[model samples]
Target: MRTGKPSKTAIKVSSSIVTLGTTSYGQQILPDGLVDASEKILLASGVVSEKGVRWIKSPRMVSVYRAFDWLLPGQFEALGERKAFFERQVRAGIAAGATQILVLGAGFDTLGWRLATEFPKVKFFEIDHPVTANVKAKAVSKLGRRGNLYLIAEELGKRKLPDVLATHGSWNRESRSVILAEGLLMYLPAQAVRELFGQCLAIAGAESRVVFSYIPAGPDGRLDAGRWTGLMLWLQKVAGEPWLWSIEPQNIRSFLEGIGWKIAPELEGGTGRHSTEYFAVATNQA
Candidate 1:
């Protein structure tokens, strides 16, 4: 397993990898080390057993399992869906003769490496925390696979993403760029979410696309997100990431519109009809 001072929140979420391995689907999508790291974190945090084979199952657990089942082999079907969405945008950009991709909260995700291999002409920028980024960099380096990959380590909210892109000489206004922020928005406060979207807008033009996932606020616009919300709160408490923010699905659209973003239709998945996870594409129209 990779060695680093991962935050308690990160460690807790990593445990999901272990839980993922128990399912046949999770093993197919996530790398062995990532799975191991997640299991190890869960064990260290006392969220799972020492052997890392079993998980503290709950409604949330069952729902996650169902989601993985829906996506198949890759314990992260949501990721695959998001990847497909990004790929479509990329293909559109290619058709329009555009190049360049930015992935926020790159984490231990393998999309960049996979996309690089698939589209050698495209350049990828992966932004993440220093510790997490180092872990990913080392893993990819050991694999001996290269793809015009640049890793930038910085706190996602505190730093200026546009400035970072400019410093790297990768910022291009003419190119069609796609930004991915998967499994990230739910963890941030409402204000920070707006700020991050604002930064993305500054870097992107009218033609650029931003795809992200978020946990929708229930009818009340509060954290009482029903079955899944309870599970997340329990998981967060165990993972030491008690701070979570959620917004009503409708309010999210309004907020995006307020930010001058033109949103596409919301994509929903999961077993619970009410507990719909959303995938929205926002175009920087302004």
Candidate 2:
């Protein structure tokens, strides 16, 4: 489990890698090339010899990754759906004249690398913990600096993101940017989630947009996400990261509106109906 410092949080990192692996190798979520490159890089990392990256793309790991789906079927299906939502947001950002692209909690994903090439003028920020950022930097270094990828290494719990950006980021509060927080919000408490939105508002212009995925939890704060099963307990024990906050899809509008964002859209899987998990793209209206 390649994870966090002073404790074992790398397992969560590997969990993200597993998602990339299964999707990269199995579902062909991305028909184009390089979709699986990051997973390939992780497999070739030093941790493979140290057994840091495992249970992904292999039968056993794929089975465990799929087990949560059995309890709440089509959750895996939803992950596939999320890939499209992210791309749409990025395209919209580029069309909207975004100066920078911020990928918050960017694990081992390669979206930044691809986006940098596709949009040469836009600077891409891949923000993550120092450990994950370090490993990703090394592996990506072998690929030879794709474009203007600025790596900002910092732990979110240790500091507010805008402050970290002030120290390490090239863009600023006035910069028109698009933010992606895929698979990140669920780990934060509601207060922290509120703080995240507040920070987004502080930095964003009226045109700034954010796209993210969330797990809808019941009133007790347990995962009843969109009529899906709640396997959060198993995740807390296995991955060491638990689902902490949730909101119903319909309420997402009010939630963002209360925070000064205009509702963009909530997209679903190719199946039409939203999967167990859903994605929302909200723009800063103020």
Quick one: best lDDT, which candidate? 2
Question: lDDT by residue for model 2 over 152-271, one digit each (tens)?
Answer: 777776788778878865767787889888877877779888888878877766688888888765666456754424454555547656667778766778988888877775322332
Q: TM per model? A: 0.71, 0.80
Candidate 1 lDDT tens digits, 1-286: 1235545444434555445555565556544344544443344334345544444333466466666453223334444344345556555655654467788876665556666766778787888777777666666666645657777777777777887888878667566777888667776778888888888888875677777767666687666544555665776667644536677766767888888777765322222222235666777645
- The lDDT values for all models are 0.62, 0.67
How many clashing residue pairs are found in candidate 1? 3
* Candidate 2: regions farther than 4 A off: 1-28, 47-68, 219-221, 225-231, 266-274
